[model samples]
Target: MKEEHMAKDKPASGIPPGSWPVPLGLPLYVTVEQAAKLAGIGRDRMYEYVNSRADPIPQMRVGRAKTLIRTSAIPDYLRRRETA
Candidate 1:
């Protein structure tokens, strides 16, 4: 069933199955801390991105008190940093 879903380009469950997805592909979801670490930014900065009402934001809310950042958004986040 998992392989079938993978073949169809769908996640194993309609709901994402883990704290983070394997293979590091697009539409990836991760916790705030994880996302921040991946983005190479401070936790507060990550929150800023999550809370910002601006364009090119990189954060998402998974559940109440549970926020996720998309892996696809990482490049853009890094690009926002001049040195990155």
Candidate 2:
């Protein structure tokens, strides 16, 4: 079907297509690039944080292949920055 092909054509971001219900809600976590876009910062900066041990925004490593940032952590980190 056309819908099936459309899903296949979309790039993979580790998550398998249709593995979960769409329109359910946004993901709890996101790739570093998505985090960067959400925070209006560069991807490089996000990567730096991921590498740094003292980073306020915590990152998760999945099987040594993918790095993700918690969606809730982004704003929390920014607030911490403001207070500090």
Highest-scoring model, TM-score: 2
TM-score of each: 0.55, 0.61
Q: Which stretches of model 2 miss by more than 4 angstroms?
A: 1-24
Candidate 2 has a TM-score of 0.61
Report per-prediction Cα RMSD to one decimal.
Answer: 6.9, 8.8
Q: For candidate 1, write residues 1-84 as lDDT tens digits.
A: 977768677565565655453444634677777778876789898777777766446666666778777776766666775562
Tell me how far the alpha carbon of residue 11 in candidate 1 is from the true structure, in angstroms, after superposition: 12
Model 2 per-residue lDDT tens digits across residues 1-84: 997787787745546666643234767789999999988989998787677777647778888699888876887776765653
TM-score: model 1 vs. ground truth: 0.55
Determine the backbone clash count of candidate 1. 0
The candidate 2 region of ten consecutive residues with least summed lDDT is 15-24
lDDT against true structure, model 1: 0.68
